[model samples]
Target: MTPASEPATATSLPIGSDADLAWVRHQVRQFAAEIGFGLVQQTKLVTAASELARNTLLHGGGGQAKIIPLISGPARGLRLSFIDTGPGISDVELAMSDGYSTEGGLGLGLSGAQRLVDELTIDTEPGRGTVVTVVAWATGVPAPRPGSR
Candidate 1:
C-alpha cells in the first residue's frame, strides 16, 4: 500500500460534450476493473461518474475529471475529481442536501453520489466554478485522515 503522504497514480480526461459522458463512464469502469474493483463497486463508481459528468456538461458547461488509483495503509482505493469552469454553486450546503435541485432534477445527484462513495468533498465559488472529489476504497472503508471525522 502507498504511504499516506504519497500521491497516487492518476489520469485526467476531458468532458466537453454529450459523447464524452458515455466515454467517461466507460473509462471509469475500465479503470476500476483494471484496479481489481468488484462488479458492485465498479457499478457504484460508474454511476457516480455518470451523474457528475452529466452535471459538468449540463450545469458547469464542460470540465474535466481526474481518476486516481490509491493505496494508503493497506487500503486500496480510487479517487475521482470533477472540475468545471461555469457559474459556481451558490449554496453548497443546500446543493448537497438530499432534496435540493435547481434544474428540476429528482434532487438526488450530489447526495446520491456522496452515498455511493466512501468520501466526498465539494469546493465552489459562486462566480468561479466547482470542484467535487470522491473516493471509494476496495475495502469499503477509507483510511482515517487527519482532521476528518
Candidate 2:
C-alpha cells in the first residue's frame, strides 16, 4: 500500500442524485477490472462503493467521490473517498457499530463497507460534513489457501 503522503492516480465523480449511484458503481467496477481484480474482489469493492455512494446522496445530501488507483510497492489497489457537506455525523462510533442507523436502514452500510476493504477511515464533525475513505487491494495472482498446500 502506498503511504498517505504519496500521490496516486485519481479521478472524482459527483454524487448528487440517485442516478449517480449506478455511475459510481460502474466506475468502481471498471477500475477494479482494469487492474485485474478477480470477480469476487470486484464485487466486494463495487458493493462497498454502492453503499457509500448511496449514503452520500441520501444521508449527506449529496457529495463527491474520489477514486484513486494505487500501484506501488507489492500491491495493487483502489481507494475511494466520499465527501459530503451536509449535517455531519454526531456519533461516528455508534454510526459504525452494526445495526446502528440514523435513517431507519438496516444499519449495515458502514460496517459492511469496512469488511469489504483493506482499510477504512471516517472523518466527520457535527454541522461540518463527513468524509469516508476505503481501500481494497487486489490479491494479484491467486495464492493457495492457507493450509491447502
Candidate 3:
C-alpha cells in the first residue's frame, strides 16, 4: 500500500523526439498501473501524455516530463508535468478552444487532453516556454481544480 498523504516516487524523462514520446506514454502507463489505476484510467492517461508530449516536442522545441505518484489520505493518483522551452503560447484562450490548431491539423490536442484527465493546467509565457500538468485520479478520489494544488 502507498503512504497516506505522503509523497510517493516520481519520475523524470526528457521529451525531445518522437521516440521520446513513446517512452513517455509507456512510463505513464506503468506509473498509473503502479498506483492501481484500471485499464481505462491507464489508457486515458497514456493518451493524454502522448498528445502533450507531442506538443512539447513539436511546438515547444522539446522539454521534459515529470511523473509523480500521489497519495492524499485514501486518494491516489498520478501527476504528469510536461515542460518545454520553445515559443510560448501567446493566446492560451484561443489555443485551448476546440478545433484550434496552429499546425493545421484537427486542433484537438489541448482540449482533447483536458477531457481525458481529471485535472489540467497550462503555464506558458510567450517567447519563453510552456508547462502543462495533468492528473488522473483513481476512482473515488476527488481531483482538485487548477490552483488548488
Q: Tell me the TM-score of each prediction against the true structure.
A: 0.87, 0.89, 0.89
The digit string of per-residue lDDT tens for model 2 on 1-149 reads: 33332335688999998789899999999999998899999999999999999999988999999999875554567889999998999989899999998889999999999999988999999999999999877897543232322
Superposed model 2: Cα runs more than 4 Å off: 1-5, 141-149
Local accuracy of candidate 3 as per-residue lDDT tens digits, 86-146: 9999999999999999899899999999999977899999999999988778875654443
Candidate lDDT values, in order: 0.83, 0.86, 0.86
For model 1, name the residue pairs that clash: none
Arranged by lDDT, best first: 2, 3, 1
Ranking by TM-score: 2, 3, 1
Return the lDDT, model 2, position 132. 97
Where model 3 places Cα greater than 4 Å from the true spot, the runs are 1-6, 140-149
